[model samples]
Target chain A: MTIAAMQGIVKRYGNELALDYVDLSIHEGEIIGLLGPNGAGKTTLIHTLLGMIPFDKGSIQLFGRTEKVFSHENKQKMGLVTQELTVFEDLTAKENLEFFAGVYGLKGEERKKRVEEALAFVGLSSNAGKTPAKFSGGMKRRLNIACALTHHPKFLIMDEPTVGIDPQSRNHILETVEKLREQGTTILYTTHYMEEVQTIASRVVIVDQGQIITEGTVNELIANIQHEEKINIDVSTPGDVPVERLKGLEGVKNVHVDGSTVQIISTVGSGNLDRVLSLVKETSGVVGIQAEKPDLEDVFLTLTGKQLRDGEEE
Target chain B: MTIFTFALKRIFKDKTNLIFLTLFPVAAIFLPEPEYWPLLPYGYHYFGVLILFVGIRLTGLLVEDRQKGVVKRLAAAPVTHFQYLFQNLLAFSVIVIAQCIFMIAGGVIYDHELHEPLLLLILFIVFSFTAIALSLAWNSLYRNKETSFLVFMCVIIIMALLGGIMMPIEMLPDVLEQLAVIFPTYWLAEGMEWVVMGEDTADFLLINGVLLLYTLLFLIIGSIRRMG
Candidate 1:
């Protein structure tokens, strides 16, 4: 079932358009990754969906009912984990959960039970009495997710919840997200990390310039791109390799060399591996050669004409 | 727990706030009288500035919330923005009222004579609303907490000097005296003067009413301006 849908959404700040004719939807039990570069209207879209900011023109439907704005009751069914750490630094881990849970109208034994469950969910049960001031970046991020989880909303909106943290914590959050989906919680997760979308998102939505540029499953997006194959050739001396001759190959679309590694993007049935290897063999010693499928980064670059990290095409 | 309780708890947890809460009231009781300001006792006159600092310190938490993105998160939650602002204001007011009580109790302990204790309490409470509302409005104009706080502290000190809390308003130049009336501190000093002289009750109430008007004006301005 459709959990939430935004249609023809237009949001503007003063004269600058933040969200321009954006339409997106979330489904039940699915983790929808909202991927975009900096200032791509991802956070603006979330704010508009939650009615935290007004949209110039749009319609929103929540729980299968169209409304001009979600009511207080409707909001109670949704949870938001903001990109920045929003948990109280002065309050203890458990008090933080209890305060947010209480705001959601969870009371008495239910509130207590949910707080404990959330703490355990984030693997912070032992540090429940400790304040967030002493938590490491990863633990704080976990507590941040736990605070949002206390009320147990059916739909959760996590806006770059794992932006800056240790890999262990990032993995823990990803695992937690997967677990939440297994329990039938629908999620709309936004992030700049394409690999994160690849790791867990059931469906991916790519946004650029305040619009939904393209979206699909990871494999489907990779398949839809013009270049279907990626070749990584490691050489002892990459500088001596004939980059121009490789680019001159009939099926090769792009060539990027970094350090001793040369990456080549080519058509799916290029049949140029032998000739390409011969040319490289003439100049430099080949350490390794691997033929692989294009990933989301390639797909994002192919469609958006920009890299994910720095938004540069090459 | 309600936002009110959580806000109060956060304030209490801050050790810096404890120093301001406890030390100032005791100091207000023992401070020497201002020789220039004979209309009201020195301690009573200076207590106005102490409460102003307390009010701004409390509202600084709201500024912290805005800077930290907690306010934006609250905006996404089930609670309304008005509830967040109102509950926080209520909590700050409760702290200010407690400060008033401490000042009153200090008066009793130190034998610092008060012409009318209850009237002074009412005046302090009303002035506190104006101070808190002013701080709120001031905070909305800036996004950086440190810059906003430092600039406001300087402004408050200037206001206290010109509004008759430091010296008699009558001794100021005519032009400065006319401009002094623009500040809420001026009305606070006026109210204290009425309480000390056992003046007409209506006049004392009028000064408080003016302070309330300033409070209302500042509250409206603060509510309209969005913080970071």
Candidate 2:
């Protein structure tokens, strides 16, 4: 079943268009990873869905209801974990969860039960009484997630929930998200990290300049660009390597030189590696050669013509 | 917890606020009364400024919420904007009212003359709302808490000084006295004068009415969304 659908959505900030004729649909029990560079409308789209900001035109069907204004009941069915750490610093971790649960109308024993469950889910049960002021960045981020989970919303929107944390905490958050999905919670996750999406997102949507450029599962996205093969050759001196000569090789798509490494992307099954190697051997001694399989990073680079972290914004 | 109780916890979490809440009332009570001033008690007049400062300090939590993106998160929650603002404001009023009670109790303990004690309480309660609104409205204009708060302190002190909280308004230059009405502190000082002098009921009520109007205006101005 479709959980939420945004049709022909249009949003503008003053004269600048933030979301232009965008359409996105999220289904039940699926984790959708939203990928975009800074100022590419990912956050804007989430805000529009949550009714935090108004869209200039279009209709949104949330929980199968097409309503311009989000009702209080509809709001209770969804939760958003913002990119920034927004939990109250003065409030204890448990108290923060209770406050948010109470806001969603969870009362009495139910509120207490959910608060405890959320704290345990985020692995902060032992520190429930400790205020966020003393918690590390990772623990605070976990509490931020727990705050949104106390009400147990079916639809969750997490915007870069693991932006700047240690790998262990990031893994914990990812595992928790997977657990939530296993329990039938649909999620819309956005982040700069590509592997996180490759590991967990059931479907991936790539957006740029206020439009959905492409979307699919990780393997499917990589498969679309699988026709190209990336070859990395480590040379004794990369500065003297003739990049233009390699670019002239038949079926070579692109060539990039970084430090002592030279990378050549050529058409798969083109048999151009020998010519590329011979050309590299002419200038510098070859140290190592690696034939790399395409991944989400390459797919993203090929589709958007920009690195995943290019022009990052706060 | 509800927003009101949560807000109370957030306010009292800082240990320094205890000293500000408890010790300041004693200082305000003992402030020497002016011999020539027959309108308002000198200490009570200064207490108006004290309540205003306390109101501003309490409402700074709201400003911090905006600065740190908690308001943006709250916008996505089930609570409406009205619920958040009203509950936080209600919490602030409770704290400010406690300060008022402390001032009244201090008057009794110090054996100071408090004319029309009930009316004086009403005036303090009404002004507390205005002070919260004014502080909230001031906070809406800036994003940084420290800078916004420091600048607000300077502005509020100037307003109090000019509105006769520090000295008699009649002693000011004629032009300054004419301009004093623009500050809500002026109406607050006027209400104190009404309480002390047993002014007519209609005029006394009008002072309260003007203060409420200022509260309404400030609340509207403060409600503008400044979150990023």
* DockQ metric for all predictions: 0.68, 0.67
Q: Over 4 Å off in model 2, which ranges?
A: A228-291, A311-314, B32-34, B38-41, B226-228
Task: Classify candidate 2 by CAPRI docking class.
Answer: medium
| Model 2 lDDT tens row, A1-314 | 99999999999899999998999999999999998877788999999999999899989999998854488888989999999998888889999998899888999999999999999999999999999989988899999999999888999999999988999999999999999999899999998788999989999998888999899999889889888788999999878998888898899989998989999998877898888998898887799999999788788788878777763322
**Interface RMSD for each of the candidates:** 0.7, 0.8
Per-residue CA lDDT of model 2 for B187-217, tens digit only, reads 9888887777755899989999999999999
TM-score of chain A of 1: 0.84
Q: Which candidate number would show the highest DockQ if scored against the true structure?
A: 1
Q: Estimate the Cα RMSD of every predicted model relative to the unseen true structure.
A: 4.7, 5.2
Q: Candidate 1 clashing pairs?
A: none
State in Å the error of residue B87, model 2: 0.7
